[model samples]
Target chain A: MNIHIIGGGAVGLFFAAQWCEKHAVTLWTRTEQQAEMISRGGIRVLENHMENIYPVNSKKIESLYVEGDLVVVAVKQYHMKEVLPLLQNAAAQSVLFLQNGMSHLDFLEQVPHPHLYAASVEHGLAKIDGRTIQVNGRNKTNIGSLRSGTAGIIDQLQTGSFRFDWNENSYHMLIEKMAANAIINPLTALLKVKNGEIAENARFRAIAKDLSREFASVFSYKTAEDTFQSVLSICTKTADNESSMLKDMKAGNLTEIDAIVGVLLKTAEKNHRSVPAFQLLYNMIKGKENTPEFMSK
Target chain B: MNIHIIGGGAVGLFFAAQWCEKHAVTLWTRTEQQAEMISRGGIRVLENHMENIYPVNSKKIESLYVEGDLVVVAVKQYHMKEVLPLLQNAAAQSVLFLQNGMSHLDFLEQVPHPHLYAASVEHGLAKIDGRTIQVNGRNKTNIGSLRSGTAGIIDQLQTGSFRFDWNENSYHMLIEKMAANAIINPLTALLKVKNGEIAENARFRAIAKDLSREFASVFSYKTAEDTFQSVLSICTKTADNESSMLKDMKAGNLTEIDAIVGVLLKTAEKNHRSVPAFQLLYNMIKGKENTPEFMSK
Candidate 1:
């Protein structure tokens, strides 16, 4: 099987480095410069204090061809829309979206793709530099089929370090993952604290409750307290780890604010639920994201 | 004339350095170690590409004696209560407060001192190291007499660099100054941006308006829109500078959240007014203030 990984980010690099052992992998990046670097030197994984290189064919997304490939969209939610047209322009045997947040879900439902899937990539991977990825935490790719009558892509994607799980219902899986993501991602990014801080810090926990309660109103939760408890547990479990949103903000990458907070805020407005904490943080992250680190004298 | 400056922070050092030249100035620090360091080395002023030392007597707050001295309480709002008893122990000729926020206003209302005053010190100052200070923005100390018919302390506080203004109505002056501080201080500190970013950044400005409106409810504003415009103008004027709260957070000092936001929240709660934005920032600053930067592994 041939896997075409869209995006040369930390996610795409990790997948390409892992799945290349089982199947042929081609990496697609936004720029030809990154593709050329990866094509010439290959992806480097700095793991267990050792440098290991994985060979894969890398190309620019501007020249993407997905006819005979299983295209796994690994780009951020902010950039997912830009790449969606390219997938529609070509025909892939299977298209799997590994983006965060529910922003892309609406766009996916309208598409006539017969074999469509969405995934939650639960991993701590950092792209150190050009074609170099540093793997930290263990990874599990949760796959859910978006389209009916489609055999999932779980069988095609497995490696020694990479794990895969097939969910019976994709929407619920995304919601569950999002419950944690929506709570943890923006808070860590805004506060510039580790994941555990949200649960450990009393004030953060207070605000977290506000966020969870607001989030619960938009989605279905038995109680906001139960939702908050779940979010706190996730925070405690990943206490030492800096969230992906924090990492993205630190690296000056555009965050999935629109998909995660923006979409939920839209729902909240539609429902007439007053979610001040969520709205406050959304505005904060948007400000920080839009504003440069250094300003003029 | 003798001047007693409480709290050996940037503001204290600035006043002490200026006043010591004209008056018999005694600097009071929280610890004996800092007092001893200043007593031995003198206060170093790094200015205009030259390092100059200003000599003055320094003592620990524990050994405070304000018999005939004009006492200037230049402590942060968090530590104001701790030093209040010391002031009560010794009857100073005049007691002038140089603190931020309206938190100290209530404490001053019942005090029967004939020469009680509240001040708003507008300056950008940074203490480089132990017993060393770096001045940035020009200084203006707005003095208002809290005790009715008491002569103001502005006449005794003239210096070449340091400026003072007597506010006829102290309450209104503090409120007006607070309109800017409450918005700029926490926002700049929380966002980790310079003062100007609040105005320059659209998202920050939106949240600033939210904060301004909520704050206006606690106090009285002609309109929240007017309050926000004033706050934005302050941000634009000091766009290149960092707020004292941001500097304090960076330096791991206790912030004026309690005095600024905490007191406002209390008033808001009393009036049955909803100030979620103010409450959110208060909680955030409190969390960041209480939580350690480096967590135990």
Candidate 2:
């Protein structure tokens, strides 16, 4: 099988490295430096279970053929607008998105893609010191086809990369994952605290629960309670993993708070749900994110 | 004038130091060490405008003379229940409370003694390093009798110690002070931010306004707008000051959140006004205060 990976971030590089052992894989990266590094040396995956850097082909997407059996879109949600259009030849192929949230629904609806597989991953992977990569744990990863006819795509990807599953109720799974993300991610980021801090605080829990309730209302499901419990479990599972949101905030980078929390809030507004707690949380985080140092201090 | 000051915290020591300049003053304290400090070396008040260690007699009040020219009770609200009997002597003559929030109402209802002056303070004084006191800024002090025929008391105190004013409407003044304390104190404390943070974040201002609205509804007054504006002014005046509530939270001591926020919220319930934000803030602070580090961290 021939595979083309878009966006040479952690997930993209990880998947390329994993599949290159059995299949011909080409990672489409934007930078000449990264492309040259991967073309010369496959990919370095410092996995918790195994540690090694294998060689693979990496090239600029414009110079390589996009007509592949599978194309993995691993770009940030904000970057998907530009990157999605670049995969013109792979419109008929199954595209697996290994990103965090489902903010690409508008793009998904607009584009006539043949098959789509959405995944919500709790894997602790980080590009260490900008040169190497490290996977702290073999965390749970869920993947499923959005369309009913493409169940086989989910089956084919079940080969030993990480744990992946198929669900008839894939939308519920996405919303559940989304609810958890909205609650934990922004708070961990805003507070500059670990994932465990949310569970440790009843106020934080209440705020998270309220926000989840708003999301559940929009999705027409009551999953916040279960999802909140799952969040606590994830805290214990990945206790040492600094959440992406937290890292973004610490680095003074703009967090994907809009994709994770803002989307849920907008959806709730569209659904006409009253979410005062979430509204307060949203306002607080937005203020913290936009606040100047003098005012904040 | 002969005066006796109870509770050797910032406010008590604050008024004691001021009143001792011209009058015979005694500071009653619980901690023998603090009592000894005041008795031997005198009370040191280092104000931005002035600095002095004025000598004053210090002792524990097992009992007191039933007659005095003036007395100021400045204990915390929670301690008021146990200390009311102790104030019986002072209540017979002339008594002024220089404490935060509407905590004095409980004592006023139970013991309706004549010649009572319920005062509200915005003076920014704090005990910096146990022995040393720091006055951050000058804020007006308001004093008035809860009942009639105490104009002389208000006038006498206003003429001397501090920048004082007499309000004919003392209940309204109490409510106004309650509104200010309810708004400014808890937010600065719980958010672990300075006073200016409230003005910087509009959400905190909204919460402050909501709390004030709740107070207005219960007390049948229209001080919400004025009180909120005053709070913003305070945010500027004490931009660098850590509020008493914040100080208490940092010290792991019980915050006056109850006296400031809780009392107002309870009043809101009595008047059938829903104070969602204030109730939420109160619950969070109370929960954090009661729970141990294991539960909250």
Candidate 3:
């Protein structure tokens, strides 16, 4: 099987390294420098106190599209617009998206791809520079079918080190994952605490309970308590990790707050529910994104 | 007229220094050390390029209550419980309460004093030590009669450097002031920003407007928009000052969270309205107060 992975970020590099073992994988990067570096040195992955590099073909995004059996679009939701055209033009048999938040679900309706799928990655991976990567805890990458007749593709892609779990209801899966993201991300960012504090810190936990209950009332099919419990579980599992949003804030980078909280705010509005916590967190994160120093002493 | 100013904080010391120049002022301190310090060196007040120290009578809390004509109670709402018995047994003709929140309004009924008044200080003040104080922007102290026969007391206190503005509707004036405190204090403390940033920062301003509007709808006599406008005006006026709550958080001291937001939360509950932003800010501040390092990275 031949696969094309888009974007040179952590998720992109992780999938490229994992799938290249059994599949003919070509990593597509935004810059020729990254493509050349990866092509020359291979994708270096550090795990279990071991350093290993996987050799894979690579090309810049602007280069001629290499027709592959599968194309994995692993980019931030905001970058979806730029890469959507590339995915549309690619002659891949199936296109799978691995982006956080449900924002991309809306734009997927416009895509002409025959086999479409979306996934929430549980395994936290970090891409160091163009080629180096570190994979934490071998958590399952939950994948769900957005378009029919794509169950076969899900089966074919299951044979890899990157664990893939199939969910019949993709929307619910994304919502649950998003509830975790929306609750944990902005809070850890704004409060500047590690992920565990969301659950361990009594005061933060109280607010998290309110936010989770409010969020589930408007968005979740699961009961508010269930959703809140799941959020606490995630915090405990990733206790030591600084949330991506917090890191983004420290580096003064634009966060995926729009994709996470912005989508929640819009859904709450459509549902005619007043979610003040969601609204406040959304506005606070957006403000922090524009000026990191604004919220600081 | 003889005046007794209870409490030795910045506000108490400022009032003692200002009023002692005109009226015979006696300051009461919780600690005998503070009383001895003030009694020996006088209350030093820094204002308008002038360092003025006024000699005044001072005593510890357990000392016999002086038979002054007017007693200005300048303690925090939390300490009101401890000092209520003191105020009740005092020989003063009128007892005036100058606290930040509306919490004391409930217990003011228990005070057996002949006349009662409550005030909200507009002037920003800081106690340098047991005796030294800094007074910023000599804004008028708005006083209102909490009980009958207090109009005369407001008039009598008007002779001092601490300008007193008498309002017929004192509850309304306190609510307006509490609204400002509710909107400004927790935000500055949580976000670690100056008072001005609440109005100047676009993201913070958006949250502030929403919070203000939500708060006014449940508590204020003024419309939500009108209340929010007043909050903005306040942010502009005291842009440089560090809110007392923020200072308390920095100093790792217990804040008046229960007095300010706790009272508001109870009001919201009684009104059967949900205030998520208020609840969240309250919990976060309480969490911060308990562990100042909890919210920080």
lDDT (0 to 1) per candidate: 0.80, 0.70, 0.84
- Local error of candidate 2 at residue A226 (angstroms): 4.9
lDDT of 3 by residue, A1-297 (tens): 888999898888888888887889988899999999999999999888889989989899974356877788887888888888777788877778888899998888777768888889887666667889887656788888888635556566766566677888999999999999999999988888888988998889998899888888788588889888999999998887777788788778889999998988888889998889888888777766855664344
Residue-by-residue lDDT tens digits, candidate 1, A1-297: 787888998999988989888888888898889999999999999876889998888998885646655788888888877887887765666778887888888888555567888888877777888699887666588888888624446766766668898898888778777878888998888777889889988898988887777788888644788889988877776667788888878767778888888888898899888777788888988877734352110
- Give each prediction's root-mean-square deviation over alpha carbons: 4.1, 4.4, 2.9
Best by TM-score: 3
lDDT of 2 by residue, B1-297 (tens): 888888888888777777777778888887778888888887788876677887878887667554567777888887777778788755346677776777667778665456677888778778875346788876778787865545666445554447787788887787777776777776676566788878877767666665566566666657567767877877888888888877776677887887778787778887787665566566556656643341233
State which docking tier applies to candidate 1: acceptable
Sort order, DockQ high to low: 3, 1, 2
Where does candidate 3 clash, by residue pair?
A: none
Best candidate, lDDT: 3
Higher-lDDT candidate of 1 and 2:
1
Candidate 3's C-alpha runs over 4 A off are A31-60, A126-136, A154-161, A294-297, B31-64, B127-130, B159-161, B294-296
Query: Listing candidates in order, what is each one's chain A TM-score?
Result: 0.92, 0.87, 0.94
Candidate 2: residue B91 lDDT (0-100): 37
TM agreement with the true structure for every prediction: 0.84, 0.82, 0.91
